[model samples]
Structure formats: C-alpha cells, structure tokens
Target: MSPSELMPIGVFARRCGLTSSALRFYADSGLLPPAEVDPVSGYRFYGAEQLTRATALRQLREIAMPLPGVEAVLAAEAGEASRLVDAHVAKIVGDASAALRKAADVMSSLGGAPALPIAALKGPVLADAVEQVLTATAHDPSLPVLGALRVEADLEAVTLTATDRYRLSTRTLVPSAPPGRTWAGTVSGDDLRTAACHIRRSALVRLEAGPHGIWFRTTGREDRYARLLTEEFPDHRLVLDSLGTVTGRATVSKEPFLRALEEQPGERVELRLSGRAVEVRPAGGRHPGIALPATTTGAPLRVRFELTTLHPAVSTAIGPDVMLDLRGHDQPVTIRSADRGDLTTLAMPVNPSHGPRR
Candidate 1:
C-alpha cells in the first residue's frame, strides 16, 4: 500500500465535516480510497495524517469545484488549488461589484438611499479584517456614518462596499456561518472603518439602520462601528493597480516581507530596476536569493522594480508568496510558490511616472 496519512472512518468524518456514509461513498467512487478495511468488523480506517488533504478536499467541495476538478487540484503539487482560489476571488469580486453597483443605482432611483449601520459592517469581515480596512484608511481618519452604503451575502461569502468614490475597498467575507444567516445586513464604509477598532472577532453583532444614524449593538459588547466618507478613500483598486514601475523577481522571507510592508518606518530599498531581478535591498542590508519551492516553466528570471510600491503588495498577502504580475514590462511575469495559498504578496507594474499605462 502507498504510504498515506490515516484515521479511523468515524474520527475522520468529524474532522472532515463529512458523514461516515459519505466517506464510504468517496471510497466507493474511488475519489478518496481509505488506507485499509477491517476484515472482521467491516470497518474503514483512514490515515490521520491525511486529514489536512481531506479537509482541503472538503473545502473545495464547499466552493462547488467539481469532483474531477477538485481531485486534479489536490493531486497537483501544493498551492495549485490556492491559485485557483485567487482567480476565483478576483472573478467573483468583479462580477459581484457590478451587480452591487446596479443595485445601488436602482435603490437611489427608488428614493431609498441605503444606510448600512456600523454593526452590519463589522460582522462581514473576519480576523485581520480590521487590518484590511485600516490599510486603505491609514492616510485618512475619522469616518462618518453615511447610512446609504451597501452590504451583501451570497451562499459562500459576504461583502461590504461603499461608493463614496475617490476610492473603494471591499471587505470580502469567508464562511463564518454562525447563528445569523437571517442577519443579512449592510453599513457605510465610514461606519465600518470607525467601528472595526472595537468589534470583537468572537461576538455576535446586531444591526439597526435608519435615516438618522445606524446602530451596531452586540449582545454583550461595548463596540461601535466607525463611519467615514467613502470619498476620502482613493480609488484603491486603481491606486493599487497603478503603483510602481518595472517588475522583476525578488525572493524574500514571507515574515520579513510582511513586516517590512506592514510595520511603520517601512523598509526602504534603493530600487535598482534591472531587466530581470527587482533586488529588495533592506535599509541596512541585502539577503541571499530566497530559494522557494515552485512549479513553473520558464527561464530563470531577474528584473528591476520600484521599491516604493512593493510594500502594499507584500503586506496584503492572504497566503505566503506574492504573485508578481508584471505588465508594461518586456514581458509579463507572474511568480508564486508551488502551492497556491503559499503566496500572500502580489505586485503590479506601473508606468515610469507612477501612473497606469493602459
């Protein structure tokens, strides 16, 4: 038998969030064959070590990826599924945003400008969600509750977006699926920014929205959502997309890269934009080429980059590595680890003068 992580069928079922019968179904279908079968008692045994892979399989199922597709993704080297996930998030975010804009325009025409309370805004984003909002709001503070913002939740996720315009950042939701599927809600961007500071990651939030001001009261908490003008936010998508010039590969530690971008007194490096390597020389030093596990079919690439703009790209990593997408360059390059979620940083190339060129 192939060496594999195994667990008893019953124990594995609870961890995988699948029923024993369903596991048997997987084995029957040859989707996930168990390690061994008990001859005497007619029972199944799964390797405990396979739990992570099994759980990943279930998550893919939750997202509705087909069985064959799911198997293909899992069977590939790690991070393949994560890349698929990032692509999915981008596509969905775009489609959902369009639907939301249409819904807002309709609401405006009907005379009911939406008002999303601070409470409603707080619930949509999960851990590090506050950090997510703060990244965009760092330059501006003191958000006021506008009341007519938008909030939405589809089966797999939820979203909070405000269109005060100069900038818009949407907090994409993952499945928390607590008690309130019925608690579908919305809130202004300002309310969200202001309130994120006090919102508890573990508490259930109750929302009350009206023409006056929205109220976000938790069952046993003392938190209030922050409401700020969406107008103050720069068109972050555009801003983020338009940043930096020249693109190339730079290998660095995920932890250091994260801190360098996220912490104050941000790391300053003299960007020596070369054709291939975008060398990330720290203020005090230079590190070796960060050899990473990867899956790609290309020549060893080196390039130059605009050091200033790489920070935001690095800090926003939901995973580990950055998918450095370089347009406007001699050739566009996308880099990441062998596994999908392994990359957390993403960089986009800009025109020489810090503006987007097409």
Candidate 2:
C-alpha cells in the first residue's frame, strides 16, 4: 500500500482506543508494528487493518496478561487463542486469590496478640482431612471467614469444614488426643494448605491457638502460623439439619460422570436422573447429551448446577461411585462417597429459569 493509504499513528491510536505512546511501545515490543515510517521525520503510520489487533492488544493488557502470554495469544489460531486466554485467567485467579487470603491472615494477626498451644493431632491425618475439603473453601474477599477452614476438635473426632455459600464440605477424622481437651478455630485456607504440606512431610504435627494467631508445628520440620479469622462461622450444622428429607437418590460411577462434566463446554448444565441412568446436557440446549448408567431410587428428578461448583464435588469423591441425596429442585444436593461416610459435599442447584451459559 502507498503512504497515502496508511493512517498516521495519531489517527490509528484514536480509532483503536489507544494512546500514540502505547501504540509506539507495542511497536517497539513487536506486538503491532507500524505499517510505514518516515525515515527523516520519524513519523509512524499504521494500516487501518491493524485496528482489530490493536484493540485486542489493549484488552489483553487491561487484564494484565504478561508480555509473553500476550504474544502467544496473538500468534495462536482463533480456537487456541481462546484456550490460551482461559488458561491464563484460571492461573491468575488462583494465584491472586491465594495471595489475598495470605494478606488477610497477616493483617488479622497484626491486629491482635498471640496465644499458647491448645490442641494436637497427627500430621498425616490432618493433612489428608484438609485436602479432602479444601476445594469447598470460599475465596471471596468480602466474606473472609468463609475463605477459612473451620477446625473443630473434641474427644471423639476432629472435623474440618469449608464452604463457599453455594457448596459445603466436611471431612471427619478420629484424632488421637487427650480427653477433655477440645478446641475450635478458623484458619485461612491458604495457611492451612501451606501447613498441610509441611505437616505431611513430618512424622508428628501439633496445633496451638491463641487470641491472635494459630501455629502448626511438625516434628523435625519448620513451623507455620497464621492469624485466625475472628468472624463467626455460619451455623453449618443448622444448614445441614435444614435439608429436607431425601426425595430422590442416585448412585453413579464417579470417574465417568466426572469426566463427562469436565469435557462439557458449557458453564452450566442440567443433571437428570431417570430410572438407572443419569443424563447431562448443556443448560441452554446446545450441546449433545451424555448418559451414564447409575443405580437410582426414590424418584426421577432433574436439577441444574454451575459446572464450576459441581465438578469439584464429583472429582473429589473418594469411592468408585458417589451417592447423591436430592431433596428437591430448589434444595442443595448432598454428594457423598458411596463407601465413605467421613466426607460429604453439598452443592446448591441452579434455578431452572436462569439458563446455563456457554
């Protein structure tokens, strides 16, 4: 194209919603080079065709995509570009959420004073229990307490609980402890994950809680501590008790069903139990359906759930098959390993009127 056909940098930036300097920087970085340049005047020019790429670059930068990632996204085909963006978003969300949780724990600790140890438990057991329910913890900054794992211990058993309002999970383990010593506290999920890693590598683990912070120490290993969340946890027991009587039940093979859900392209899906088969399909009636054989009882029922919320419960189920206890269309569904009574995951079903998104 001739020089007359090329748009000046100023005009191009205005059309692309970018500043001239930003366009120049992108050019310097080889993201979007000028179509032509005046050697003597040092003026840059861009083709009108570059507007689409420039706008996309601006959006990618707005989301804080790294330079290399941006380049990869630009270089990819349409389908691959989408996958790249999705992968980057998932990683950043996970990392930023963890950092926020850690920062919140630190700030809470600084606000109060420290206390002495109160309870102890086995390292491996605690690690396993925490891992089992960690996925259920809420990561929302507005509700700090919900982002924590509630640790409740007594003479009989030690229980770890986490919930994201929409879903609740609890893992119970019998603890080897001295009688009459009981304790309850909420620790940030990020801190618990870190402590669990150290605890699993050690032979013994001890827990101490005070007014300000909680400490976890492993025999022959480094210790870790974080500020406890002082906000009161929701009465989870009441929520559990409030669940209506089981109106329907289904025992489905865990792996195949979980795989089918993972492979689904929609954000929300409908789960229907009819006779001895479970059918899964996109909520908006777009994709082909998947059917899996299951052992069902009580009644035929259909419910909708956000794929994000339902996948974790199915993926974490321990046994070969999982049992679903359905109360009603509006009630939360209780999912438990068919063979294990120690762990349970409850996910709230989506309203049918609100169709699932792709």
Candidate 3:
C-alpha cells in the first residue's frame, strides 16, 4: 500500500504484458484501477497484487473478448469463470463458421450462379438422420470425402449416407416437398453438425444447392450453409449391391442387446445366433456370455465384430427392437429397426480373434 512499493505505469505494463495506454484504459473502465495516484502530477502506479488480474485481462483480450465479457469473467468465481471462458470460445467458433459461410456465399453470388432447389425436409427428422448417419464418418487425412456425408435426393425421398470403411450407415427421409430434380452431393460433416441444432428447432428446412455449398433455409430459424467437398466419395452402392444373401437373422430387444455388449469385457465381441436367443460374448473366449431373448431364423451362426464398429450401429437404431441379418462369419452384418427399415447400417466383421481373458 506504500508509494515506494508501487510500480510505475510503464513498469507495470511491461511486467503484465499490457501497454501503458491499455492500463490507463482499463483503469478508466474501473477494471484494473491503479494502486496509487500522484494527484498533482497525474501519475498512475500499480501494485504487484494487481499483476494476476492484469495478466488475465490481457489474455482474455487476446481472444477478442469484449469489454463487458472480460469484466464478467474477471469477476466470476473459479467454476463460473471456466464456464464463461468455454461459452466465449464456443461463440467465437460459431461466429467464425457463420462468417466463413457468408463469405463463401458472397463469392458465389459474384459468379452469378443461380441457387437450385434440392429438397425440403422435416427439421427434426433431418436433424436426427444427420446425427445418426454421421456416426459412420471417420477422420482420415488422406481421404477427406470419407469424412463427409453423401446426400442423394430424388422426387420420392432424400437419402443421407456416410461410411468409415468399417461401417456404413444410411437413412432415407421422405421430403416434405419434392426436389426440383434429382441431386447428389457430399457435404462437410462438421458443418452439418454445427447446423444440426438450428435445424432441429425449425418446423421445416428447404435445401438449396449452389456452386460450392448447400443452404439449409429453415422456416423459423437462421439459414445455415454447409460446404460441399470436391473429392469423390466412395461408391457405397457397390458394397450394398454386392452384399450376399443373409444366412442367419435375429430380432432382439435393442436395450438388452446394447446392455450385453456394454458389459462385454473385450474389444472384440462374438454374437451367437440360434433358435430363439442371441448370445453376446467376448470373442474366442470360454466365458459364458449374456443371452437375450430373441426371435431368430435361418441357420445357426456366429459372427465377430470390433466393438467400435458394432456399438454405434445398434445404438442408433430407431425402435425398441433391432433386426440383424448375417451373411456369414466374415461378412458385413446388416442392422436395422425391426419395424421401421428407413435407417440401416452395415458393419463389417473383423477376422476371428481371441478376446482378453476375463
């Protein structure tokens, strides 16, 4: 509190990573008032105790936090301060995404290209489908299109599909209004994820395709845009068409099936399908596994899958019951809702392997 112990404005600024003028500005704003003032000479001095707050203020400002936000963050408790910081970062990211989309739209307009109508869909349904199908996407630096969602639309329905080589998921959504014509594009999955929240809140969404991007013009929410990838998406249809006939089939309650998988001790899981039960057990292990009551038909069979590939496919099913169709031991298994076949996932089984001992 003594004048001799106080640091002059220049020294304080140097130590705190702020300019002298910034100190004065914050002082005037009542955020970082100096420890002492030489009234006659109008000199300002700050104490060492103020360094922590000044340093935090500088760091907050570096992130472009507004004055009011900076003030609130500074005054908040530790937990609240952390939450505020996260919220601020989220807003910045959302703003940056929106700005980038707007810039792209502006550039697109300068080219004088017309926006073509793609399709119209129910907001909640489209949102759900996007979330479900996107689970199949993977981050592969070598092939970016694999990280995107392939959207194909026709007069009858619009289909969303994505694949990560190991798993392929697709859902067909009946459009509220038919498309102007048939259309297809691979959209950035990250952009779609960011737009999902807004899409879900609206009653309807009209999709408009431009040269470089697609727009989700919602009925009562802000329009969102997603960039289209130029890289070619994999020919998922080939895999679908080449699928072998199912040799074994089982319909089981989804909740119990998922629970059994959850309690499995290993990364590889084996499913044994017989007369009226599906045994979920760790792969290649002697452990007696959990069995769920199921209605199974066709030949008895056992199939193994990586837990990573199988869990999401079943968890995203629409209803209480899931139907699994198996072609053979090393084939891609088909998973879909027992009653509603609109959404389907094909999960590839890995080679038979031993699971960790219980």
Candidate 4:
C-alpha cells in the first residue's frame, strides 16, 4: 500500500475518536496493532481500512466494556457481537443496582436508623402486584413522585398504588403475617423493578422500612433494598372518594377486548356501549367499528380514550374477564377483574371531540 494510504498515529487517533496515548496503549496490548511501524523512526501508522474496527473499539470502551470483552466483540461476527454488547450492558445494570442497594444500606447505618419491620408477604404475590401496579408509573423530570409506588400497609393488607395522572392502578395484598405497625411511604419504582426478579423466586419476603429505604428480606435469596422517596404521593384516595356512581357497566372477555383495541386504528379510539355489545372504532369515522360481545347494564354510553392510556388499564386486569364501570364519558372508567376485586385500574378518557392525528 502507498504511504498516503496510512495515517500516522496522531491523525488516526483524531479520526477514531481516541487520544494518541490510548492508541499506543491498545497497540501495546495487542488489541489494535498499527498497520505499519517505521523501524528507524519507531512511529505507528494505521491504514484507513482499520478505521471501522478502531471506531468499534472506541465505542465498546465508551460503554466501559472490559478489555477482554472489547477484544471479543471486535473479533466476533455481527450477530454475536451485538449479543455480547447486550450481555455486557445487562451486567453493568445489575452491578449498578447492587451498588445502589449497598449505598442505601450504608447510609442507613451511618445515620443510625433502625430497620422497622413493615410486613411479611408471599413473594410471588408481591412480585406480581409490583409488576401490575408499576405500569401506571411515569418517569417525568419535574414530578419525580409520579415514578414512585406508594406502599401503604396495615395489619390486614398492604396496598401498592401508582398513577401517572392519566391512569391509576392499585393492588391490595393480604400479608402472610401482620405488619409490625401501619406504615406508608413512596418507594422508588426503579429500585423495585430491579429487585422484582429476586422477589419472585423467594417463598416469602419480609419488608423492613428504614429511615431512608426499604429492605426486602427474602427467605433464601439475597436481600434487596429500595430507596424511599421523600416526595408526597398524589392523593389517589381523594379521587377514589370523589368518583360519582357508575351509570353504565360492561363485562367482556379480556382476550377479545384487548384484540379489538389492538385492531382499532388511530391513536384515539371510541367505544359505544348499547345493548349487550361494545363497539370499538377509530375516533374520526375513518373505519367501521368492531363489536365484541359484552354483558351490559344501566344506561348506554359513548366514551373516548387515547389508546396509550386505555390499553394498559384493561390489559393489567388479573382475571380472564374484565369489567368496566363507566360513570360518564367525562368521568374516569373503573377497570378490574370481573370475578376478583383485588386489582383495579382507573383510566381517564379523552374528550369526545378529540380525533385522530392528521
């Protein structure tokens, strides 16, 4: 190859987004040796053809991939390389979660706060409730509490609730053992999500609330900690109390209801309830609606909702059949299992005037 085809270390480092020292270190480590080295001058030169590999190496290092992992990724095929990167990321995330839990423990110890026993619950049941209710949490920079799950525990039951303004989901779990005392706090949703996998496998989980966080002491697995948020959770109980009486009710098979919603076109959807069926349609009359069989009572109603807000509320119901209690088009619709009342979701509907985006 011509001399012009090779770039000196300084120029090659600039092109590959790596410093000259980094290039020298990698070359010394046998990871990215230069294309050519001048014997007399003792200088390194990289060919233009090596730029792709150099760039990939830089990216892998940017993600904090260890040297061995980076080397493996650089040598692997495209699909294998992608999988390796994903595995590295998962490991980093798991490590970070463990670090945060350790930090929380350290802080509690430093502050000399005792861990107060909160409640003991079945691990599988707690895990299920966390997954279902956390669907209502939203991540917003301004209101961090919206991304938290409220834990309220008493002697009989522990209730988990989350709301993203548009939708609210709540699940009540009867503890295997009574709580030491009544307790309520907003626990970080992210932390709970990280700990959910371990929580699911354990036979039992004892919740202990500390001054700064909550600890999930499992029967056989590693204990996990969830930081407690100081922000005030939204007054969901007020909304529940203020709700008007249900004027229309419908019970439909969960599968068909979800399918109808999935097949419905546009971002905004309309539901017309009359007789023993509920019709799902695009908001702007662009397509004919599909009717699903339902058990109906009370007055007929026409309601509108953003597909984003409504689908999750119905899909998260616990049982095969879902019941919708509609007060009015303007009111929030109550969705829950037709047979079991433990899990309930409230979805706010859009105005009838809202139409599909142009």
Worst 10 residues of 4 by lDDT: 349-358
- Residue pairs in steric clash, candidate 2? none
Could you estimate the TM-score for every candidate?
0.40, 0.68, 0.76, 0.83
Worst-scoring 10-residue span by lDDT in model 1: 289-298
**How would you order the candidates by lDDT, starting with the best?**
3, 4, 2, 1
Q: Using TM-score as the measure, which candidate wins? A: 4
Report the lDDT tens digits of candidate 4 across residue range 56-136.
999999999999999999889999999999999999998999799779767876878689999999889999999999999
lDDT of predicted model 2: 0.83
Candidate 3 lDDT by residue in tens digits, 84-196? 99999999998889797788768776887787898888899999999999999999999898889999998899999999998999999998877779999999999999999
Residues 267-315 of candidate 2: C-alpha lDDT, one tens digit per residue: 8888988988999888767788899999988778888899988999888
Clashes of 2: 0
Task: Identify the runs in model 1 with alpha carbons over 4 angstroms from their true place.
Answer: 1-127, 138-156, 160-171, 175-194, 207-209, 212-214, 228-253, 256-278, 282-308, 328-350, 353-358
Give the local distance difference test score of model 1. 0.48
Alpha carbon lDDT of each predicted model: 0.48, 0.83, 0.92, 0.91
lDDT of 1 by residue, 185-204 (tens): 33455445445545555355
Name model 3 segments beyond 4 Å from true. 1-85, 108-111, 353-358
